[model samples]
Target: MTKPDQIKNRYNRVARCYDWMESPMETAKFSKWRRELTRQVTGNTLEVGIGTGKNIPYYPEEVKLTAIDFSKNMLKRAKLKYQDDPRKISFIEMDAQDMIFEDNTFDTVVTSCVFCSVPDPVKGLQEIRRVLKPGGQLLMLEHVRSKQKFLGRLMDWFNFVPLNIWGANINRQTIDNLKKAGFTKMEVNNLWRDIVKLIKVRNIK
Candidate 1:
């Protein structure tokens, strides 16, 4: 299988248990960050890697939303969870690196804890930039390689195990990758010790 396919399969295999594994973190910390990041979203929105629909409940009711995930199993679970919500959300199974969307299509793009697993992070971000209208905002809640030397090295050492077991890398330089993807006006708020960041950027195309 290709690398992306491998990653997709990994997520599919874990879809049923994904939320359980994340329960502790989500309850204590991630849920707050997800809420804070999603509440800022407005206009027609696209959420990439909308895993398990964790951010769905937090989005404002007025915003029109479309969400996608690479794993069909994951999207299936997400759809079930949000099936009865009042606000409409379209969920699709799609690869982040090659989204089937027109250029300059969305007014806002958002993601939560996603980029770490994308096989080609820059390529995925480039696709996000492509579908985003000029002046559209990209909001992200992501964990990256730590800035502190010892902790960063520790995360680097631990990353390989998760990459093999769950298809997630704990040592990605996501902020740098976003810049490389061509987003110029950006603001980053360190949510937790410089590892988890709330990043907002604009597509200036």
Candidate 2:
């Protein structure tokens, strides 16, 4: 809890303001990728960093969903979104670095635009891999360091200040992290030359 304070503070402060802060076109485009990824989520699905539960409604009604976030305010706002359909969502206050769920309990692990912000991406990816069942997917929609070297360098330079202020590192190499975890089946679709990334990893059973 204390460890994720910066992450908590930023999102908590923006929980109510996020929709306004986020660009409509950017949000809509990202949602399309998430919707496509959701189609592969069968049986039990664990969604990490599910800020305000934005992806909740997009998932098929038949899917069993469990969502977690460290920010209390973020979860509070998300609860309001699901107030009418509470049974469809089980909200938990937890961290992605160490999920409380049993190993192999989830058939699909969903992460949307979260990897770039995690404090320790390798550990986070490891945790996601740990909870998934055999043949399960680690579906990710992330904003990573851009493929454009110049833009990526700029992001790296500015990444430190935001990391201190909000616990988000905008310059993570998430593609490498998945590989380090022994997840070899990689399908990465880029949006705008690497500003946004959609990665799906089929972990070994």
Candidate 3:
């Protein structure tokens, strides 16, 4: 199977229990991060990985929203959870590396804990850049490789465990990847000891 297919299968297997598995972290940190990230979205918005609809309750009601995930099962759960949300949301199954939207389509793009699992993170981000209008914003809440030499090396050494078991990498240098994907201006807020970051990017082109 292709890498995206592998990721899809892995997520599908865990979809039914995924929300429950993440509840602990969600309650402690992710919930607050989601609210902080979602509330800043404006105009036509695209959420790249709307897993289990966790951000559904936090989004502003006036913005037009479209949410996508490659795993059908995960999207199904998300749709069920927030079907009654006041804002009308379009839910679609799409691969981040190859979105179907036209160029410069979205006013803002958002992600949460997503790029760690993308088979080619730069390619996925390039696609995001392509779909965003010039000067559009990209908001992300992600856990990335530590900058501390010791912890960074430690994460690299054990990165294979999460890659093999969960199809996610724990050692991605995501800020660098964003630069590689053509995002220029950015504000990065360290949320948890340099491990988790809330990144706001201004798409230059």
Candidate 4:
């Protein structure tokens, strides 16, 4: 099976039950953080991972939205989240590693706690760069491994086991991945002592 299909199959198994039993406190905090991170965006936006459509309501007025997710089941949940909204958004089932769009098509690329789960975060980030117009920004809200030495070490030790079963890595350093993806103008500020970060990156190329 294709990678996207594998992702879909994996998340589909957990879709119906994920939102309810998932980390409530983490979800709430991430939701609040996404609001702050995305407040800087303007123009056409593509929200990668658009999981469960959790950030759909928080999208600013006047911005055109195109939400993409790898899993059909996740998009279904997100559709329910915006059932009554006056805003219209295009939801597409596409892999973040490769988007079916021309280069320089989008003005902004938004990711809310999505990098950790990508099978190849670097390749996915490169795709974000590929579709984003020059000087456009990539707005990200991510939970990263702690900057503190011992805590980071512990996260590294525990990440592999859970990533196999849970499909997300707790210790992924997304900021580093963005840099590797050729992002240069980056402003990263921690929300909760290095655990959560709001990163705004521009393609300086």
lDDT of each: 0.92, 0.80, 0.92, 0.83
Q: Write the per-residue lDDT of candidate 1 for residues 1-205, one digit (tens) a residue.
A: 1299888989999999999999999999998998889888989999999989999989999999999999999999999999888887999999899999999999999998899999999999999999999999999999999989999999988888888777999999998999899988999999899899999998998
For model 4, residues 1-205, the per-residue Cα lDDT tens digits are 1254555577777778777756686476766776787788789999999888777767888888899988888888888878666768888988898899899999999998788888888999999999999999999988899989999999999987656654677998888898898887899898889888888888776
Better of 1 and 4 by TM-score: 1
lDDT of 3 by residue, 94-157 (tens): 9999999999999999999999999999999999999999999999999999999999999999
Best of the two (3, 4) by lDDT: 3
Q: Which residue ranges in model 2 land beyond 4 Å of their true spot?
A: 1-3, 25-28, 161-166
The alpha-carbon deviation from the true structure for residue 61 of candidate 4, after best TM-score superposition, in angstroms, is 1.7
| Candidate no. 4 TM-score | 0.91
Q: Could you arrange the candidates by lDDT from highest to lowest?
A: 1, 3, 4, 2
How displaced is residue 203 in candidate 1, in Å?
Answer: 1.3
TM-score of 2: 0.90
Q: Rank the candidates by TM-score, best first.
A: 1, 3, 4, 2
Model 4 Cα shift for residue 55 (angstroms): 0.8
